[model samples]
Target: MKDPKRADFRGPLVDRRALLVAGLAPLAFPGPARAEPSPAPFPFGVACGDPTSDGFVIWTRLALDPLAADGLGGLSAPTTVRWEIAADEAFRHIVLTGEATALSDNAHAVKIEVQGLAAGRPWWYRFMALGHRSAVGRAATAPDAGAATESLKLVAASCSHWETGYFSAYRHMAASDADLTLLLGDYIYEYSYVGERAAGRPRRHDRAADVVDLAGYRNRYGLYKTDPDLQALHAARPCVVTWDDHEVENDYGGLLSQDVAEDPGFPARRQAAYQAFFEHMPIRRASLSDPWRLYRRLAWGDLARIHVLDGRQYRSPAACATATSRRGSVVGDDCLERLQPERSMLGLTQEDWLYQGLGGPSARWTIIAQDLLAASIRQKGRNGVVGHWTDGWDGYPATRDRLLSAIRNSPAQNPVLLGGDIHSFWTTDLKADFADPESATVATEFVTGSITADPPPYAPFAEMLPENPHVKYFESRAHGFMSIAMTPDRMLTDYRAISDRRDPRATVSTLRTFAVESGRAGAVAA
Candidate 1:
C-alpha cells in the first residue's frame, strides 16, 4: 500500500520532449504485446477530470465498436490496460505508471486516479490497452491550500443535445486556452432522434430509442462520445461534470420523472442510468456509489472554491405538479404550493453542506457550479403581478431564501453562481426578496446557454426582462459557452456564440463581456 503521507513520486527521469529537443537517447516505452493493438479499442478517446492538489483521474473505455447494440463496447472479457502520467508533454520523464483492468462489467472502461505528484503544475497522460496507444491529454494539480495566484481560467458550458445541431460550439471550446472545462449538464440526451425534418432538426441517432435500461443509457453515452468535436474537448482539458435531467429522462427529479407520472419502475431505470453515468464520466468512485448525492466542493488554492450541485437528483417535485397539468411550464399565484418551506431544490443534506461551504472563508472567489438557474426569473406579469415557470429556483422560493440568507450571513467572499440548463445566457443579481424591489443583493449569477441545443423562444423572454429588474443581461440567440477568468478582485465572463450552429465550419465569436468586481454584487460592462 502507498503511504498516504508521501509528498510526491518525482525521480531522476528524462522528459518526453527532451529526447528530440536535446538529441538525447530516446526513452523506450513498454515493449510490444503478443499482438499489436489497433486504435479501434480506444474509440471514445481519452479524458481527464476531477483534478486535485496532488492528482486527477484519467479515463478511457476499450471499445471495438462504440455503437454496439449491447453497449458493451465489444469487450466480452476482462482486459489489462496500461496507464502513465508524465511531467511533460513527452513521456520521457515518467512519474507514475501501472496496470489496471478494464472489466466487462464496467463497460470495459478504465479510470486511474494518479496521485503523489507536484502541486499546481500541468501534467500529460495517455493510455495503452490491447497493444494500442491512446491520445495524450492534459490535466493539472490544484495549487496547494492557501496558495495564491493572480489569475485562474476555467470554461463553463452545458446542454449539448446531439440532434439539435452540429457540435461546432464544442469544437470552438476545445481550442480555448483554459485550465479546466465544466460540463454543467445534459451531457447526453436520453430521448431518441425521430422528429420531422420540417422541424429544422439537424441530426438523428444512429441506432437507438429513448434510453431506459443500463444498456440503453450506455449506448446513448457512447453515441454522443463518438462525435469528434465532443471527443476533442474531453481530450483537451480535464472536465468537471454534473448531470441534469435528459441524462436519465426529461425533468426527472429523484424517483419522479418529468413529462410523465412516477412509475413503479422509475427507481430501476434511475439506477441503470446512474451506473452508465459513472461508467462514462471521469468522476471518482465515491460519486458513482450514490448518484443522488453528487454535491461536492473543490478548491483552487486560495483563488477560488467550486461547489457543484446535483439539482435534479434529490429536488422535490416541481411546485405546480398537478394531477391534470403534470408540469408547471408557467404560472402565478395559482401555484400556491410553491410557497412551502420544505419544498427543496438541493434537499436537506446538500443544503447543509452548501451552507457550510458558504459560511467559511477559504478562497477569494466563492463559486457554485450548479445545473440550473437560481434567480427569480418570471414571465406573464402585469400590474405588479408576476408568475414563474416552476422548474428553476423560482419554484422553491423558501429554498432560495435559505441559500441567499446563508450567503448574506457567511464569511464567503465574492459569492457567484455559475449555472446552466436555461438554454440562454442570463446575468442576474440574487436578491434577498424578489417581491421587494429594494432587496439587497446577496450574490451574483451568470447562466450560460446551450452549446448546440435549441433555446427557448426569445419574444417572451424579451418581454419578461423589462418586468424583472434583477436580470441584468439576457440573450437567447446565441449557441455557445462562457469563458471566465478569475482573479483576487474581479471575474471577467465572455458570452461567446457561433454564427451558424448548423454549419460544421462555423466560427465562434464573443457576443458580450461582463465583469464582477470584488465587493460589488452584480456584473457590469467590462
Candidate 2:
C-alpha cells in the first residue's frame, strides 16, 4: 500500500510552487528544438483504450524532460496540438485529423475520444504538440453488433511495483496480438525510500506519508512511466484499466483510512486521486469526472459485453478490527453489515444500469472486469478457518451473492469474472456459498497475480488446496499476468508467469489453463 511502514522512510512533502512547476512543464517549451523531430514522446508514449464500435479514446502526455528527479519540467504554457489517424503504419492516407489542446491545469496531457469510425477496423494514430511527435499507436474498433464472431483475445495484467521488478510482462503483452489489454489496478504504488531509486535517479516528490495531493500522485505515475517495458506496451496497443487499493490508499473506504491515528480525509483524498488518475490515464472524456466514476460497459459486437467495476470508491471498510490482526477472518461483521442488498460498489444507479443492460444483451459471454476476486475464498490457517482479504469482494459477501444471483437469472450466455489485487493467481468456481463443498458454481473467476509484487510465499496454504475442491488451481510463487480467449462455445484463460520477477529479462511461461463452456459457469482444467 505505501511500502508497509518503515522508520527509515520519510513521508511526502507538500509545496505549492513545486507542484505548479511539475504540472506546467509541457507548456513552457516552445517547439521541437531539432530539425528532425523525434519519432515519439520518449518515455510517456502514446496509447488508446475504452473502445467502442464508433469511437475510442486516444492518450499521450508531454514529457519535455522526463528524467527530472522531481518529475516536473519547466513548461507552464498551453500548447496547441494536432493528431492523425491512418489506415497504415506508413500513413499513406490520413483518415482523421483534428486539433487538441494540452494545458498546464491538466498536467499537459490529452485524451481525445474520436467518433464516426467503422467497426472492427484497425487504425494507427499519433500526436504532435510543441513540435514534438508521439509514437504511432495501434488500436482497433469493436466488432459489429450481433455479428457472429469466431474468437476474441485480450491480455490481462496488474500490480507493476517499480521497486519490486521490471515490467517484462508488458513486453510479452506487446508481442501478443491482443485486441486490448486489461489492467486490474495497482498502476502506481505510493512509496518513497532510500536505496530504492534507480542509479543516477534522484528522489521525487513524497506524499508526506502517502499520496494526498496532486503532485504526489503525479510523481508516482512519472516514476512508473520511466520503465521502458511499460512504455513499450503503451506504444504497442490500447489498454482498459481499473484501480485497486494501492492506487489511493491501502484498505481505504469512503471516509476511513487504515490507521486510526492518521487523518486520511478519504473523500477529499479520493477526489484528488481521481483527478490525477484521469489526467494521466488514457480514459474517455465521458468517463472523466471530479471524483472519477469508472463503472461502464464495453460491447464487442453482440459477442460479449464487459462490465468494469470500481471497487475502492464506494466499498465498505475492512472486516478485521486492526491492520496487524493475524486472525483467519479478516472481514469483520461491521464491514459485512453495510454490504446489504441496497449497498453497492458501483452505487445503486450503476447496479440498476448493469442489471438492465445484462437483460437486454444476449452476448456469448458477459465478463466483469473488477479489482478483486468475486469468488468466495476461505483459507485454513494454523488456528482455524479464515476468509478473504477484507479489502476484496469477499468482505461484502451479501453484495457478491446478490450480484451472482442476478447473473444466474439473466439471459447472458456465460458469466465470467476477471480479478486482480491479490498478488497470487487463483481460479475458482463462483458458488453461492464456497464454505459448502457441494455448492453449485454459478460463475467462473480468474484472478491474475501482480505484475511485479512478490507473491506470498507458498506455505501452509499450499498444503490446504486439496481441502478446497472448488479452487481448481493456485499459484503463490510467481509474478506475471493472464491471457484470455473468448469464443461462442468456450472461454479459455492461460495463467502466464515470469521466470523471476527480480530478473529484468525473465522469460514468461504458461503455468496452467482453464476453460468455461457456454451455459456453464464453472471452470475445468485444460
The numbered model that scores best in TM-score is 1
TM-score (C-alpha) between model 2 and the true structure: 0.86
TM-score of each: 0.91, 0.86
Sliding window of 10 residues with minimal summed lDDT for model 2:
13-22
Clashes of each: 4, 11
Worst 10 residues of 1 by lDDT: 18-27
Report lDDT per candidate: 0.81, 0.72
Any runs in candidate 2 off by more than 4 Å, and if so which? 1-42, 67-72, 193-209, 287-291, 320-346, 380-385
lDDT tens readout by residue for model 1, 1-526: 8743233544433333322211122224543323343557888888999887777888999998787878898779899787777766766556666677888897998887766666787888888877778877888888877787778888889999888788888888899998889999989888765646326677786554677888888988898888889889998888888988878887777688665655568889999998899899988655456644567888889999888888887788887776633454666877788889988988888899899988775688998999888898878633445688687788788888999999888889899999999899989888888877689888999999998877988887898787799988999988899999998989999999988878887899998899999988889888
lDDT of 2 by residue, 443-480 (tens): 88999998986566677667767757788888888888
